[model samples]
Target: MSEQGSSDTYEENERVLVHHQGKIYEAKVLKVEHTDTNNKRKRNTLYLIHYQGWKDKYDEWIDSSKMLKLNEKNKELQRKPLSSLKKKPNNNINQQHQQQQQQQQQHHSEESDDGRPTPTPSPSTAGTSTTTTTSTTSTSSTKRKRVDASVQESQRLDLSLPETLRKTLIDDWVFITNDKSLVALPRNPTVSDILDTFQQQHQHLEHVKQFADGIESYFNKALGVMLLYKFERPQFGEMVKLHPNKPMSEIYGAEHLLRLFVKLPDLLTLTELEDKTSVVLSKATEELIKYVEKNASTFFLKEYAPVTTYYSRLAN
Candidate 1:
């Protein structure tokens, strides 16, 4: 379980689960809440999650204790063994071969029917016309083609954020002051809102605004959205302040751990996916993304794109 606060629940995009709706699912928590109604306050804490399928349509809520923290070890344990059912063998010969044999037999009968043939050397003919029977046996075995190497490698990967982000979100942060434990943040951060809070700390909203713009412009909208998800808006500045010299991938490694999908353009069945997907993407970077956008919430080892360590980290 993640080291979340007793009072604070975890979100969906940051957690992972399996056996959801009768299928194994690997997902991150998007939201977490407790359902408690007071006379004036209505608190329904439901954790919105982003899993393999459903993208963001379905969410599950339980008491804080029921929410399990997603980890690499847990993911490996969820894998089920593949069924060994084999396909029936097919040994039928081609129809063309049968037709050719019939044609040769007909030609031989016609040749034997020719009236000009009159060679009859009694006992010598019997010896020369001796029949010979020969038998030939042929064996052919079919082997299933192996899965692709790139696909196999991708399947082996655990698509989640880095350990540092995981520890920060679920564990107690190293506190320089008493009564200070940093909570794990949302996968996406609202940059403007975060910059607003930083305005007070920086003593100038414009300076912070400029900095926020830099972050926003650092990557395209898709990656920017990923950044928001990896870090809570409030926690963004802290990560940058702590690792100013690091790349954005390292700074946003936690969101990467969730293994978010990017739509690769002009790949797979594009029309079918576009018609079904709820999340929209731009014309650019369409080729750079992966997975066909669909509502189905299952992640088959064969379906996900090529997984690489470079894409796995936020620092790069």
Candidate 2:
């Protein structure tokens, strides 16, 4: 369940040979768990566990502690006896070397073929009933590729909210989804690209001022007030960095912010008051604990961790 040797690659659903009870077994990963070491005095590492395996033509869950990962080359070598594939003397070493070089070039080219950036739908067409196209231009090619097919039929919603309000809402969401700790927008993401139309509705000046005012107004409230105040300075830093380029809401998706905020109360509900030490509050607060409980079961699904990491910035 742990990386034993020198390879840095481990992928879900890939076939792996592991040693269990002195027998070689084929297994696929069920999950990857990262052991937190920020607070501990030891080196931190991740665990790669394979709970299920194919045995006797039936699927079964087995204790993964007995398993040891085998290198791919070792596994392949094991599949064939050492005597069967004896190396022959190079009667045509020059020709063989050229052929080897050509094959190596082909492999290198194939790996570079994975350089395309994955395209996602524009935020504008989130929930509407229309279709549209959002083209993504690859650096390698001059022609723009249509990545978002839904754009052709998606119903466009009004994105006419006042800039101030939009910024506030987007700021909050960015805090929630990105963990309010991001100093700037990630490279390649423009303001418009991250903001969805649904969020634009809440990004007006009146809305943002109202939300800011509400934070002050509700400073005495039990649920949101304490949480908002704790994050106020960081949120300001976020806004400060976001100014002069695009409105806050445009840079930070508003819907994502709201989802992050709404989860606070539920998160608070789980922690014991006495256990609310500063260390826990800073790293895994009650809200974070709740958020993890709410989503932990799904974090192991192949795509979950990446999305969760994006949202963790907000949680932070």
Candidate 3:
């Protein structure tokens, strides 16, 4: 399928409208597959879909090209009226409100127990009552403010791959700095130029040293010192291992560290070469890929690009 077409298709678990047997029904994508034709040269994409009201036996793969994606507007149109499903509050809430009113009436009645008209509350007593009510109101308001702040803290904006990185990533040439910043370089930047850029961008920052230190720790835990050195001059068929205790800075200089950031694709490719016959990926490489995928959205939004375009560049 074309990149444009693939992007338009519903992703897994996304709701869509499916046309089947002269009827249209809401369906969800269960899986997506990109395969080759019988000749094994042409790409064909299929979506495994399950219609909302259909039997399990009826669930089947459909051509992705035929699927209709439901946008937010379409979804709103399809949603059933919530009023029909909403349940009225239980009797307990009403009972509590009634009990509070009854208690206040009883207090007023006790004030007139002698059957004579009750005297007005003295200034001091009224003042104390007002103060108590004010305190209670303030406490409730403070609790509400705390709840609002907690909710705000829990909500986080989604991240995406940046367009600048996306465009450069397709060419397999981009650098992600230790500070999680992205820089898109011209095609095929030389090692010297890449290193220079890294230094120029982060040299003055006081945190650069700390960031570099963190990178060293990451190298120690993820790619052992020996494997990391090998990454600089990777040989074919050599297995990469994690060396948790090895010190990265003592063994590998700053140049190798900078190269690691700039030549990430190359490093991943090398890992792939080493584990070609294996089913599982290297732990370090898997972690790296996951980070990229997870932050792709955040990075994309900062640079502001279509999600499809970002994904297309990633695939490249």
Candidate 4:
């Protein structure tokens, strides 16, 4: 049995409760032994327990883990004054006293000529009535408080988005348009395809190659674009098939993406994409920020515009 409080060690003859076949029995520890098994180096302790009211044949050795030390009732018994312990009657003594009282009650009933035994209230029963009432009232109040606390905890919110939208946002690549509208790109797009799309759109800008090179370097160093496509395509396809006309932002907005990027290191670790050099990784991250800023417009949703601005400032 496991020791209850300050000590892990238990001594023989200690009173305890042993768990046996889903029932708890009051028992005394007869012997405590530590043995080293042949197959394992660690030593294990076993307790031989003799259950109260059980025959010696039923006594057996048990693991320490299956034992629990004396509970409140036993503790209270142990703490009683010696005078009280001396006055307390054993089970056999109580039974004999009860039989004598019953015999007297039967004799009194016979003298009354009713033959039926009249119920006589015992002094102990009368004394315990008030205690039982007070105990019940206190128990009910405690239960009410626990219920209220549980209800309050259940109602508490963590301020996170719904699970589906959160999963969709983090698992797929999101795109921003010049009009400040958000889009979730199909996961099948290769790194080369993404580069082509950006180059075609910003062909007149001289610095576009820097952004492209940054993206290419990051993909080659950290996680392959092909790997992302493989991991994300099926879920993306299902979402698109369900809502073909809905903008990706409507399905999972920029706020979700903002939260996703906030835990970028955790995401990278979870996806096993952490091999990139710090310089290349940082450059790629900056390129993504710049891409969003270049495309973002004043017409963007109020909730999303601030995220773009924050990343834009970081990039600069």
Candidate 5:
């Protein structure tokens, strides 16, 4: 949660409407972090949040952005999980984090998505190319950089999609793009859950564990820029609304996680790797996806939740 107003912060024991599990619940701030930082850069405030009724096991380090004062109006704010928001959303996955300050006016209605006019990249990622020199104008320099980044994205990824899983990707696409329905977010068996399960199942293979980190590292990094479709960008958007700077793979479900598989080759285009290492890594990726696909029955959402659930529409 990156955006916070001064009033948003709370003293220890302050009650808050915690946005958790796609629903808001009352919680108390048990502890606060980053209270001492005075640097000019954005200081992320982490709260040791204790859900009122949940056992201590549910306590989490929550970003301040997700904390809302416990008030009647704020109570109904649609803190819908990204895996579950209804309606249209914009594209340009990376820009999801360039969040505007929370809209003060009540947002009683669902957000509508028009086509995105441009693409944006995350600050953490550097453009792969820098050779193109442009005019002194800032806009021209920015264009030059984007062109360079696109150049590296062109490198043919070493990983190939398995035929069966490839077919699943097609189904996933039609489910979202053509069906106009989203896989309700904070998904059950989230991408994070699935990955962790896979890692646990294969812990004996240390290399597989390492590759899990490899994929997770890039999954958090590349998901915004590489993994999202225009309609699905709403998933990422809902996340930003509730938890900025948090990794998407963790909260997003198997549906969006599958997108990571499609884009990983392009996103992780490793031009500098040795040929032998590349083959081993590519083989590892194949093995990982096969495991994920094999458990589709348990992992994938069977009935896509309509964004306009009665509870959601009744919110606020």
Candidate 6:
């Protein structure tokens, strides 16, 4: 950003809207980092903001480009969701799956990247798992726009789930959809926490380092729209009420994240991404799944919160 623009706009305590991942949140500036006095003319302005109505932990420093001045026009922008293209997707999220049914026409899940550097991506599309309460790669200032799903024949993209996780998916499906249950909130080892744990222990893994943001972005994006089952929607609404501006990565656990993989191939195919890209994302996903399996007792919950009658009423 021009020093001129930085000088003219926003100051401490000023309220604004921030475009993060595929959504926008209302924020108030706590501090402004502009070192123009050191002759830094071309540096963009960074705002350390507290997302209004959210906890301080979610506060972050974002560059000017990601922010919008608070006004009626921008408020309208904040109210509507940005498409995958407008928000940007990480191809490192390149996990693939099958569109087994023609009726499974869910929009390909979009993802939220950390605020970081861009990894060179091969031409592909992927929906990766992301967690929020801990560490995900910082979103890069430079991002590749996601490929919009086109009007073409859909194809198959698959990931082989380990038998353990396969069973977990079945049980999860039964619990949430059939038994009227919900994964309790403020989930232990949230999606963000799980990813952080994966990064901490597996620093040696190349893909983990390369596509951290992509994995995070895709998971957050998918959870907001594509990942939740119908019965869980009210619980999701409850989460939104509690953490109004926070991402799902902060609220959900491995069980919900694992479900993304089972459906990612479908999310990926929705994009015009090549079949080859699926292989790359699928492999990276396998590694993450293995880690979760190793710590299943720790990362996943054996018991779920029963859906309350009031929450069920919201569904009717």
lDDT of candidate 6 over 1-316, digit per residue (tens) = 2322123367899998654443456779998764232233444455667876654535555556455678875565444333332343343211110111111122112212111111222221222334563324433321323222223224435455676775576556545544567788888889888888887887776667554557678888877576776667677787889888898898898887787766665566666655666566666677887888898888878877776688888764
Q: Each prediction's Cα lDDT score?
A: 0.31, 0.32, 0.37, 0.42, 0.56, 0.59
Reference-based lDDT, residue 23, model 6: 46
Q: Rank the candidates by TM-score, best first.
A: 6, 5, 3, 4, 1, 2
lDDT score for candidate 6 against the true structure = 0.59
lDDT of 3 by residue, 1-316 (tens): 2222223656789888543321235778988766433334555556767766544434545554335567654343234232311232354422332333344344334321111111122122111223577878788787896786455423311122233333333222111211112222111232333233444555654444443344455444433322222112221111223333434333333223332443333233333232332222233333333444444443222221122444334422
Is candidate 1 or 6 superior in lDDT?
A: 6
What local lDDT does model 1 show for residue 307? 25
Give all TM-scores, in the order shown. 0.21, 0.20, 0.24, 0.22, 0.47, 0.49
Lowest lDDT block of 10, candidate 1: 113-122
Q: Over the stretch 64-150, how does candidate 4's per-residue lDDT look in tens digits?
A: 544556877534433443244346567553333233334434424432211111121212211122457787888879789678655
Instruction: Give stretches of model 6 more than 4 Å off.
Output: 1-157, 270-280
Ten-residue segment with the worst summed lDDT in candidate 6?
94-103
lDDT by residue for model 2 over 21-92, one digit each (tens)?
A: 222345565444333222344322333344243222122222223233456653543353223223432434
- Per-residue CA lDDT of model 5 for 1-316, tens digit only, reads 2445333677788987654323346778988765212234655556667766554534545566556777765543433333322232453221221121222111111211111111122422211222234334456777887787666554435454555554455555445543446677777776777778888887665477777777777777766665565556655667878977677776877766676775565455555555666666777777777887788788887666555554343331
Q: Where does model 3 exceed 4 Å of error?
A: 1-68, 71-161, 168-197, 219-237, 241-316
Candidate scoring better on TM-score of 3 and 5:
5
Which ten residues in a row are the worst by lDDT in model 2?
A: 112-121
Q: Pick the candidate with the highest lDDT.
A: 6
Candidate 1 residues lying further than 4 Å off, grouped into runs, are: 1-9, 37-45, 59-67, 81-316
* Tens-digit per-residue lDDT, 247-297, candidate 1: 444334222222222111211212233321312222211211221112012
Please identify which of the two predictions, 4 or 5, would achieve the higher lDDT against the true structure: 5
- Looking at model 4, the pairs that clash are 1-64, 1-67
